[model samples]
Target: MSITKSYSRPLDFKNGRIEMSYGAGGRAMAQLITDLFAAAFDNPYLAQGNDGALLPMATGRLVMSTDSHVVSPLFFAGGDIGCLSVHGTINDVAMMGAQPLYLSAAFILEEGFRFADLKRIVDSMAKAAFDAGVPIVTGDTKVVEQGKGDGVFITTTAVGVVRDGITLSGDRAQPGDKILLSGTIGDHGMAVLSQREGLSFDAPIVSDTAALHALVAAMLDCGASLRVLRDPTRGGLATTLNEIAKQSGVGMLLNESSIPINQPVEAACEFLGLDPLYVANEGKLVAICAAEDAERLLDVMRAHPQAKEAAMIGEVREDAHGFVQMTTKMGGRRIVDWLAGEQLPRIC
Candidate 1:
């Protein structure tokens, strides 16, 4: 599409609302991309204005991950759907012990959505990418008829590179490996739940939504002895550990007292009749490494602000049944199974 005549007016970002034509392939669409997304996520790659970004290849193994964000309320205690979208996809790549390089975001905006709100989300996404040292190289936007879609939905795709000889996977966990958690769990789930349900606590709970690449890099700097790295997200810590157990053909034994759960989170879970073990976390990670290197890795992890609350919560064990058992504070042991059902839906 070519435009011979200059446009007369600029998009009224502060007072305007999204329109269907802004998503159609025409001057309106191009203007929206240029005035909104491009301005927010400015970079040489996105400046190309092409159908797809042309990224230069670099040495090392390539890692790519994609995630869709549908968090309700759009805004939350510590984050919104925008930054959440960036962090979620970046964490996925970081879980593989890769250094995130670039990102691409796509928006499914509902027609009549407020332009101010859209700008806020886009700006947040751009800031997240900038803070993480990654760029949104390419993106697409579409508008769905009003009431056909929610306020907005964002899908982010991230690409990263892992150095040669540095491999991490869920199946890499083995018997006698130590289990480590980056920090307290259930913060993200509870934060979102509180906002969605209008539940208030003595102290406000904030979502632990953050990118974990730097922490993963610090762990890798310690050594390649790191067996597996996973961010416990949707199903929370219990389901994540179960998955690792089944993947590595190993069972797990956890120390109930050692598993760190913030008092507020615990209280919220108790009141809500939810298990913190099964509540989702956005910023925390579960690392399984050789028993000998566990302390060493923990030292590296604790040195970072994100992992100051890191703890050796459990150990991988030899069990054909692949059960995840936790020794309770009450001097009893019980199963920590996968989340029974949807505890919190549309929680991101």
Candidate 2:
């Protein structure tokens, strides 16, 4: 008699969760992949049943990126591991001004992982990849001891085709350029925190985890003269901006009032003693363009659904100290300095 067969149907995945046998290299493991992960992320690359995906590519410089998703509480308000993994890898490639074409995912499961939950994550991943117009080609599966691994962890590798004359990098930002933010900050982190800790709000918050290539392409199409493009992931907008400022050896001065922040998110941060600047965001981006092209660029961003809240919040300038300063809403200037301590680690 099959031990699993004795269990109840419909799988009480909400509570009855992961186990070691799920990750073990055996019949159960194969069944789990075939029925769940593979089903959700299926494509010719992943369908090949191989160790790695073999793919053809264009001649231009290829953009490749890899990222791992291991957010606590695998499922959260408005998003989960499945779509997050796809968005993470795709955004990494998009940061390079590349058109992401394909993805490969690897899953690490603790022994007792629940089949029903796995199915949900895989389905979510597939929908994201498919909707983003990128297919996951190949992948790997591994099992860890019951206690050694989290419920599940996913790592994804993406390959993209970079358009000619669209080179962008953190080091490419320059003084006198206009700094534009894609949209409001801190929503993703707030949403995740609220869901994990059972907090509720009058206005529900949702993680902004999403793919950014389409938005980037739209901006590029406008010929707004982009010098640099970056997605604010871990450490949020503050960290990413600091990295660019330091890399470009310049300073950033901002009109804080111009930056957008959801009122609910701002309120939550005040309650939690968190700064909205350093909080994590998966769907937001920072763009540095010529000062003359700022308005056109903002227009391009606002035209998109994801960037309806976008705004030009700051300007890069020459500074010996390489400091990032912002004018507060109350008309006081303060250093929007780099985060001294990790806020919300494992945020991405």
Q: Identify the candidate with maximal TM-score.
A: 1
RMSD of 2: 3.9
- Each candidate's lDDT (Cα)? 0.93, 0.86
In order, what is each prediction's RMSD in angstroms? 1.9, 3.9
State the TM-score for model 1. Answer: 0.97
Candidate 2 structure quality by residue, lDDT tens digits, 257-303? 99999998998999889999999899999999999999999999999
Error of 1 at 163 (Å): 0.4
In model 2, which regions exceed 4 Å deviation? 1-18, 198-203
Question: lDDT value for candidate 2?
Answer: 0.86
For model 2 the local lDDT of residue 307 reads 97
Q: Where's the lowest-lDDT run of ten residues in candidate 1?
A: 195-204
Backbone clashes (count) for model 2:
9
